[model samples]
Target: MKIGIIIPARNALPYLKEMLNSVQAQTRPAHAYIAEDRSTDDTHEWLRDHPDLYAGMRRNRRRLGWAGSLNAAAALALADGCDALFTASADDRLHPECIARCAAVLGADGGRDFVVPYAQQFGEAEHVQASLPDAGLDDLVRWPPLIDKALIRREVWEQVGGYSAKATPPGTFGTAEDWDWWIRVWKAGFTRYSVVETPLYFVRVHPGQLSDARAEHHAATVDLLAKLHPDLPWTAESRQWPPQHRTTRRQG
Candidate 1:
């Protein structure tokens, strides 16, 4: 499958170069694209000068937040005949085989909608949090065990109807948007498998990062989801299965 990586960026000048370098290091080199949301920094100029770094680039005159920017970039990749789409934030880094490993899992079982890879947190504290070894419908309804960056098939996107269309403002939905997306996919009967091994993506945590605000409007979004899908398993306790039961490993 032809995998395309979409990066939604705005004011990410500090780490854009290193992030692109990591993208270039992927074992199965993916076609990378950047949705350049309007930024006050030199992000646009840098992209313009280093146009060769990406397969294709789209610049938005105004900010589209995470959902909108991602939607735009995914649309471009899908239109270009990419079979699978993987999203990477400008601030994070991916392991060399991240794309290849994820592609193998999804391709192995056409029945699966997406593959959730393990993420290693850095900067603030060094730790690796493996997603639930395997997540079912109930797991997704409760929370998104997978990190934001994931490799997914075009068929899955078609089924879920894409990310939430936000008209309000960037970061308005906060981190709740990802939770909302997974909820819809689970409701559609799609299952997510966790690749429990070394980290696939190195997640960066620092002051003022937007991910820190995930809980900003989370309660409201959760309530909205509950009202929309009344049958979903709304649990007060954690339903995550222990990660020790997993045996899958990345193959050469």
Candidate 2:
């Protein structure tokens, strides 16, 4: 399937090189789009040189928040006739085979709407257990790798309309837009899965990573599960998925 990868970045110059290098390493190449948030630094200048890295690469001048910029990137990928779309954080790098594995999952699994794999936030290795709260303990916590550099079917994105662009409170109506989108797709009878063998992605994490703040706003999104996935039993067990479980539970 034809694939497009969309990266949403803001002031990620320090890590942009690593991100670009990983993108270049994807086993199956995809057209790349970088939604460069208005960076005070040289992020835009750095992006300008990326055209040489991927055919059909382009950068936008707008400063959409993570949610808005990602939506914009999806729109471009869809418009460009990509059969599937991939999402990546500008500061996080993907495994070399990330795209290929996600695509393979989408293609082989009777065409699911979402396909996710395990991701480990690099660095901060020492504080992983000490610093982070448990998903079970914090009702606000949503699982990480909540998405892969997921290769979404273009048609699925059209149905969901992507994320809400309206700005909101610090935590309100923001994070988990993708999770919200996935719940909607799943409720409509689409499938979702996690790769079995090894991790399909490696999320580079430092102080400013979006996921580093998961503890703060995860519950806000989790609270909406009932509305988003009307059919799934998003219970404590569901919230704390073990090993990996796939289901299309009919809602109560």
Candidate 3:
């Protein structure tokens, strides 16, 4: 299956090298695409200089936020006739076998809509972020069970309308876009999802990362999600952020 890796980046020059290296090291080679979201730094220039790293790249004229940037790159990959799309963070790294393993599962099982690999948090903090086996809509509504970086079928992405580009309140980025999109995908009747137990995705956890913003705006995000998905059973308890039970800890 033809797979396209989409990376959304802004002011991410410091992390791009490691991230791109991992992408290039994939056991099953896949086309890489980058959406440079008008970074204040030299991220755009760097990407422009290293044109060969990605199959296609775009530099947005203005900030598109996380989801919008991802959509922009995903559009390019889709136009290139990719059968599957993998959305990855500019700051994260993937295991060499990540693409081959996830693609193999999807290729083998027609019933699976997407495959999420277990991830580990590194950088300032280190911990294992386990993937939920056979996750469903109920698991997603309660908490984000699937990592944002997942290998999804192209049909599933088109059917769910890609990630939401909804505007957030002024001065805030929409940190829950991944969670929101997963909910929509599940609600759209693509309930079959799988989890690759290996920790193939490595997430960098440092100050000023999106996870920090997610924690800061947890209540507002939950409220917004409730508004968007009124049919779901949202409660006051849902507004409270769920604690992540780290399965493993390693020295950073």
Candidate 4:
């Protein structure tokens, strides 16, 4: 299966070179795309000069937010006829075998819709938990299982109607889009697995990281999402997952 890699970029100038270099160093390098989200920094200028890193590069006329940029990249990857799309952040790095291993697992079992590789957190904000308010106590307790660097089949992505780009008041529209999408995927009968043997992703946590900067906004959005999808089990025992429990699958 052909895998397409998409990097949703904003003011990622600091991490862009390292991120692109890692992709190029992949054991089985896949087609790469950058959805530049009107970065205030030199992100767009650098991307324009480095044509080799990305097969297709497009800049948003205005900032599309994280979810919007990812949606754009996913669309481009799908249109390019990729069997699956792999998503990474400009601030993170993927191991050389990440894409290859995810593809192998997905290809081996047609029943598996997506593969989420283990990620090791690094940088200034490593392992830092978000501050949660007492009002959203339940949402705070159970952080959704995050597939930091995930490879998802096109069919699964399409089935969920892509990430929600709508900006809800109190929280940005795309806030918690990844968690929301995963919940929808499970609700739609698709299965996702985590690769625990090897931590194939490196997530950099810095001062400007979106999650850290807008923790409250994200929490509010997640609370709203849980309300909308009550069956998601956001507070269930499966919250501490991956090696914490067996891979989730629908009962026969």
Candidate 5:
């Protein structure tokens, strides 16, 4: 399968190079695309300077936010005839076998629609996170068992219509977008998924990141999700973190 990595970046200059370097170091040869979302830093210039780093790059006129930027970049990959798409954040790094392992599992299993890899949080915070071995619709609705870093089949993405661009408060963005997408994926009937035991994805945790805003808008985001899917039993308690899934401290 021709796997394509879509990296949505916004003011990610500090860790962008490291992330790209990890992409280049992948054991499997996968095409990489960058969606530069009107970054104030020199991200655009840097991407221009290193043409060999990625197969293609798209710079948005305005900030398209996380989901919007991902959709734009995924379009480029799909147009280029990529069979699979993996969305990676500009600040994160992938293990050398990340692509290879995911591609192997998908290629070997005809029934699997997507593959989720265990992830570790680094930088300012350190913890290892993994989804349930057999996560289903309820697991997704309750809490996002899988992160957005998973490798997804191109057809599944096309069928689900890509990630939702709508933010909770209309004009704002980047709150529970991945979680929303996962719920849509489940609702669309593409429920066959697998998990990679190894921590192949590394998410950087720091102050003043998008996650901080996601936490702030948790209540509103839950309300918006409830409105979006009234059929599902979304409660005020769902707004609070679930105890079922917990992160463990990363071992040295």
Candidate 6:
């Protein structure tokens, strides 16, 4: 397989069909592997019914959460000689040309370890509805562009091990993996590029989505990251925004 797109999922079958269609509709197709994470939903039945389209698909023997399950899928892809690997959620949708555009950008001469693209929360206006801004995050710490599963070279992963198995559980991550991965990529001296034109992923925003509703968990994770990496630039203030229109100033 030239590329492997691994989706880590648990109790997400309602969105599974749309996500699968997004992958099948990609201008550039790759090996699609779904890491079940021991779902209670009818995911296995879904996979069995759609077996022909998938290059490879499997389930976790036990519930391993996002990081560990995705790592397992990545390892399987590497063993199959995939050129690159990427992980997306089961609840997200991809633009029709998302994979094609990503391949083109990552395969360019810049030797980028990963490529990024503009992304917006689902069902929201593009221009003003941008998710939690840079806040106190350095201007350089912008949102990650979407990644292409087909262009990442395996060596880059070897240097920077796959997503941490020890990290907090899925419902608790609150978008923490993205930051952790970016930090690891930055520390490894990998070239990260961003595509300014369009967004490849349309992220769902619901009350149940891990990201939309985990303030305390997210805050705790940030503190955890700070302790894990003391020298991180925006230590207590890493990539988070306070409530909109809220002010924390002293009055005379």
- What lDDT tens digits, residue by residue, belong to model 5 across residues 75-110? 989998999999899999999999999888877756
Candidate 4 local lDDT, 90-145, one digit each (tens): 88888888878877877775546777766666765444222111112233235545
TM-score of 1: 0.83
* lDDT per residue (tens digit) for residues 52-90 in model 3: 788999988888998889999999999999999998989
Between which residue pairs do clashes occur in model 3? none
Cand. 5 Cα-lDDT = 0.81
Total colliding residue pairs, candidate 3: 0
Best by lDDT: 5
Off by over 4 Å in 3: 167-170, 208-215, 243-252
Q: Please report, in order, the local distance difference test score of every candidate based on alpha carbons.
A: 0.71, 0.59, 0.81, 0.68, 0.81, 0.61
If scored against the real structure, what TM-score would every candidate get?
A: 0.83, 0.72, 0.91, 0.80, 0.92, 0.78
In the order shown, what is each candidate's alpha-carbon RMSD? 5.4, 7.0, 2.9, 7.2, 3.0, 6.0
* Steric clashes per prediction: 0, 3, 0, 2, 0, 3
Q: Give lDDT tens digits, candidate 1, residues 146-218.
A: 5566788788887887788542223362344666777777777776544546688888776555334334344
Cα displacement (Å) at residue 113, model 3: 0.8
Candidate 2 per-residue lDDT over residues 123-234, each given as its tens digit:
6432111111112112222343244346677877777677655322254435556555544554455544444344556666464553354543544445455444444445
> Per-residue lDDT tens digits of candidate 6, residues 82-178?
8777667788777887777867877788655655545556643232122222222342233322232223557777678977754453355224555
Instruction: Name the lDDT value of residue 189 in candidate 1.
Output: 72
Task: List residue ranges in candidate 6 displaced over 4 A.
Answer: 123-151, 169-175, 207-213, 239-252
TM-score of model number 3: 0.91
Instruction: Give the lDDT ranking, best first.
Output: 5, 3, 1, 4, 6, 2
